[model samples]
Target chain A: MEPVSEVSGRAIPFGRKNIDTDIIIPAHWLKTISREGLGRGAFQALREDPANIFDQEEFKGAPILIAGDNFGCGSSREHAAWALLDMGIKAVIAPSFSDIFSGNAFKNGILTVVLPQEQVDRLLEVARTDPINIDLTTQTVTTPFQDRFAFEIDPFRKHCLLNGLDEVGLTLSRDEAIAGYETMQAAQMPWFAKGTGLAA
Target chain B: MASRPRTLYEKIWDAHVVEDRDDGTSILYIDRHLVHEVTSPQAFEALRLSGRKVRRPELTLAVPDHNLPTTPRLDSAGHRLPIADPESAQQLAALERNAPEFGIRYISATDAQQGIVHVVGPEQAFSLPGATIVCGDSHTACHGGIGALAFGIGTSEVEHVLATQTLLLKQSKTMEIVVDGDLTPGVTPKDLILHIIGVIGTAGGTGHVIEYRGKVFEEMSIEGRLTVCNMSIEGGARAGLIAPDEKTFAYLKGRPYAPKGSDWDEALAWWKTLHSDKGATFDKSVRINAADIQPTVTWGTSPEDVVPIGGVVPAPESFSDPSKQDAARASLDYMGLEPGQKLAEVEVQNIFIGSCTNSRIEDLRAAAAVLKGRKKANNVKWAIVVPGSGLVKRQAEEEGLDKIFIEAGLEWREPGCSACLGMNPDKVPAGERCVSTSNRNFVGRQGPGSRTHLVSPAMAAAAAVTGHLTDVRELME
Candidate 1:
């Protein structure tokens, strides 16, 4: 995964509400053995319509998206995040996100920028004709028209996103403490580990 | 230690925190990690790409349920399982290959222990009280009924747990719901939860972990408690739990994965103390009169679009909130329904009784009780009952529940998430309406353009018998 500092590009203005994981990447596409080439499956349901914005030429390869409230609302399938990433979407500006989808996005270097509904609506409007810019350093989303909206992110999530630190990297950062705890755990509750005693 | 009365959620959570990072999140160790076919392929592929082996294979369990064919092809004896859908076949094969390749325990489609991940976890005692369990399925909250700190996770988190049996998470706020008084004779946990979701709306429990308290849950059997917790996700809750009691311990007494002898005694002692203290505080609290609940049914697409069987569907225009009205109207359009229609008057073309939500022995018995000598209506073209697990199917067969269903004109299916999401062949046709005993009622969830009315198993059984959404109480007595 790559570090996510800033993303600037034309934004896809698909602000439909309650866009669930099933809609993001429907269950049928989840059968493949490999994760590659999932961008084709992303928004397959919406893209079926001839007038769908996802299939519109102007929004092709947009790096940012403006989505409605309760985005990524259903299922815990990480393929939803993977599909977004594969479609080259680096940032999703929404009113709110399903917690599972937000976590998956962060892990995959896709920035989930939560703003107030009014701000999100504004971005969706701006995204129709102009490009949008997001700066992780300043936690702000800007448009070509000079409209600027600031947002807040959890410091830990920001740290990981900026550093390109996955869970493996995070655990490795505190190896000594983890190792010490494992040792203590092994001694105190021998039966607790059960068959997982190979390593902590 | 200072004397502090802690909620059950707090006690389990506090004990698992390996480190409080002083940030918004904490690093907590996971005791058990369950995975399914759909979400884990990429995680395993990622591991292969990164050259990382599973750090604790024994702590992980894999099963095939979603996308599994309920009625597998049969030869002379046993399921030959010539899966019709290529994608569904591939997922099962992938799970079979990945589980063994990674050295994790795999229960395949043919395995007797195979079932929905949520059902198999507790039945096998793999999900224990006071343990933090995570699965890549949203219904993982089902385990919290046994007092485990369990919730759904994404595939990336699944991979993270595979690499290191731990999670870095910001603790969710605690919400408690207390339901008192006796339930109506025909009312069930499914009805109770549907009624609760109706009151709270879909996003009501967002950002919170809910603990179900009071006499209603206490008197309810473990299976009923599991049904309530299973649909917590429908309310947008991170997880739902009931405090472990004698019933909880009794259910786990001699299961294969549970501790034994002196270890069991020690585990029991600790689990006994897992209940909330006398006056534990919570971020949110709700109290409901259990007697007020009726056999509930979802009228629209979302789980929150629900009404009692006796009530009429409210007009979207009646709601003051603009968004609520818009959502309701859209749902009504998709469901081919109009406001002010009595719920019992809505006709159903299909009736399905299965899913992680309500496919236990009790659910089967309840539905069976309603349909023992009754035959389904002529207009109802299809009715199927898929058990949650192979063990459940076998037990039902032994008790003649399968005969009761078959005798009543409903097809008895093998264990799997058959028609719940239509990943398999057991789906209602497009534009058809179905009364289902599943957790979700998302539009086109059963099939493209197919309408679903969420109901309890008993209600669904009655619908199959009457060819429309009917109240079980009407048939009772």
Candidate 2:
């Protein structure tokens, strides 16, 4: 994961709502254990049209995606986030997002900005012509015409985005606390910890 | 001091919290972790790179289903056959190697216990009431039917759980969906959920964990409840739960991983108190009349495009929102549906009757009942019945359901996630429509250019026999 604080780029004006993970990267592209080269499969179905927005010269490789409500609404495959990152997308501005997708994006260091529908509509409109600017420190998305819209993000997630934090390492640091909980759990609910090992 | 009235979700969540942070995130312990081939290899690789051992390998289970072919894995001499697809073979091999390397228990593809992770979890009693389960697949909410707090996670989180046996999380708001009246005879739990998604739209439950309430769910069998909760992701909910009852206990008793003897008694006492307090309030509430539900089917690419079986394809203009109207037009175009076309008249080239959603023995029985004395119509080119797990397949065979399906000209295949996604060899061909019992109807979900109409197993069987999307009730007469 890379730290992300500020991003300025032309946004792909994909205003389609409910663009699920399948639309982002189909199930066929999920065969590899590696996360590289997925940008080629990002929106593979839509890219087949040749004239799709993603393939257009102006939007290709754009670092930001401005979408409609409920983006990434199906499937828990983090390949969707990896595909976006591989496509050089640094941030996504949407009216709302599926909880799992939003969390996945955050862990992958992709900034998800949630704004009102009107603000998103305005950004989508401005996105077609001019580049947009997103400042995490200020929590605002700005346009060339002085249009500024604020967004709310969880403080912990904001801290993580500002500094690439290894969540697993952080959690592991509290090993003692976890062990204590396990001890208590074992005493209180003995059946819950029955091992699933084959030998057992 | 009296504690605040809490819902079942709160009770379960509170029980699992290891520590609360000042920034509103909690380090929550995960009780059960289920892994599959597709989204897990990368996570395991990350753990290996970090030199991390699985904190509690005994708490995890691995199975390969997403990319495993439902075709026979053995030859005439009973020798194991290689997977025809190289990528799938490699992925399954990775899981086979990684599980043992990490000290986790694995049910190999050839093992009679191997099945779709969600199906395997409940049947083996690995997903118990008051437990917190996480998986790499979205249908993990199926475990929530047993009164567990289960939801899907990304591969990053998969690695996180494997290394620490915990997740950093924020609590989701609670929503209660209540349906009281008795469901009509022909209506199934699949229809009930599909109709609920239709009423609420896909994003209606976003950011909330839904608790299904009222008499209809109480009367539904555990398998039916699993079918309903399996599609919670499609409705934009991370999880959907139903409180555990005596029926839940009966379903779990004597299962392989269930607590035995005195331990069962102790677990039962706690599980009995897993319901919401009488005065508990929810962040959101939705009420529906059970009689209003029909044998529903989706007409477009999204799950929210559902309608009663007898309804006609809707015109794009019928949607009030401009964006939704555009989406409707796009869906109609991709699905090759006309504005006024009746749903029943829409022909399907293939039919699929399996997935985590509807591959249990009861689901097979429902489909078998519909196909008992019937045959697939000539227009239906491909029809396959894939069981959820090896045990389910064996149970169906013992009950003669396999004979009914084979006699109907439907192929009775092995247990795996066949035709649900296009990762495996089983996929609905391009430009063809399929009536599937799986959850998603997104474009290219079944395959590139494939059109999927989500339905129940019985509805899928009804379509297979008639070569079109016919209502199961019509066959009941």
Candidate 3:
């Protein structure tokens, strides 16, 4: 996973609500063994409409996606995140996100910014012409037109995203605590280890 | 000032918090993790790239479900493996190769023990009260029926749990939905939850953990409760759970992985405390009357887009929001329905009675009861009955449920998540309509341009026999 900090780029002003995984990356695209080259299949059904925003000339290579309330509302497929990443999107600005989708995006270094509906609407308007800038350290998303929006992210997540601390890194950092718990478990409930494949 | 009492959601969450980071997030430990072929390959690949071993391999279970065919390919010796589609073939093969390499147990496609991750978890007693279970597939919340705090996680989170045996989570708000009074005899748990989803819009439970409460849930059978909780994700809840009660303990007792002897007593004592403290409050609560719920079915793309089985298709113009109205209009176009069309009058060409939603043995029995001596309507060109698990298949066969299904012209097949997402060969032909027991009603979820009317297994069975959406309650026993 890549560490994310400050991002500056054009934003795709696709402010649609409750856009599910089926819309993001259709199930047919999930058959591939590799996560590579999913951008072609991203929004396959919607992109069929020649007028869709994702297929427009200006939105190509955009790094931020400005979406409406409750985006990413279904499925636990990480392929949705992979598809967005493949499409060159680095951040998603929305009013809210489905928990599973946001978790997936966070792990894959795609920053998800939650703002109020009004603020997201304002950003959606701002995204049409100028670039948007996001600074994780400052917790602010700024537009070229002097529009500024402040957001809140869990401090732990912000730190992890900033430092690229994946789960393995996070756990290895706390090896002492995990080892301590396992040793205690060995004493208190030896049978717990019996059925388990853990070293007895 | 005294502190407010904690809810079951809180109690379980608090007990599992290994370390609070003081930043609105905590490292929550997971006791059990289930995985399937569709989502784990990338996670396993990530572990390989990072040179990591699964921290607690024994705590994890893997199975091939989403990409496995439901038709058994028999060798001359009668040995069977479920494989037909080549892409799905690769998915199952990769999972088989990855499990042993990572020290995790892989229940193969041919293994009679193999099933959907959610079904196999509780069947083998791997999901216990107060346990925190995570899986790469959604509907992991089905385990919540057994009183475990279970829910779906993305493959990246799956890799996180694999490498660390814990997740860093910003806790969710809690919702308590209390449904009191007895359910009318024909009102199944599927109807009740579909009713609940109708009450709460598809996004209503967003950012909350729903704790199902009141007499209705307490009296519900574990299978019924599983059917309800399995679709919790449909209403946007990360997880939905009921407090473990006598029913839960009774279901888990004597199962393969359940506690034994004095351990059983000790575990029961602990599980008894899994419910909320008296007078504990939730962040949000919705009260519902059980008697008011009817046999429910979906008419639109969203799970919340449901009405009474006898109700008419909603007119998009009635919706105040133009976007939702447009969505409804698009859905009607896709479903081949006109505004105010009677739901039961719509013809259905196919019916699929399976999925994590309502593929358990109880679900089979409910549908079989309706299909026992009835012949499927000739208009219902083809129908299929897929059990939730390999074990469920055996038990259903023992009860002659397969014979009844076959006699009704419904194909009784091997166990896998067939046609739920069309990862396998069981797909509805384009432009055709199907009454499905799956949790989703997303456009093209069954196959491209396929119209899905989500209903209970009994309702699906009814549609199979009637060739249209019909109320299972109104069908003669």
Deviation from truth (RMSD, Å), model 2: 1.0
* TM-score of model number 3: 0.96
> How far in Å is the alpha carbon of B186 misplaced in model 3?
2.2
The 10-residue segment of model 2 chain B with minimum total lDDT is B414-423
**Lowest-lDDT window of 10 residues in candidate 1 chain B?**
B72-81
Worst 10 residues of 3 chain B by lDDT: B73-82
Per model, how much of the real contact set is kept?
0.43, 0.82, 0.51
**Residue by residue across B110-188, what tens digits does model 1's lDDT show?**
8889999999999988888988999998899999999998899988888888887788899998999899999989899
- Chain A vs. true chain A, TM-score per candidate? 0.92, 0.97, 0.91
Ranking by DockQ: 2, 3, 1
Q: Which of the numbered candidates is closest to the native, going by highest lDDT?
A: 2
TM-score of each: 0.96, 0.99, 0.96
Candidate 2 lDDT for residue B82 = 95
Task: List the candidates ranked by lDDT, beginning with the highest.
Answer: 2, 1, 3
For candidate 2, what is the DockQ-based docking class? medium
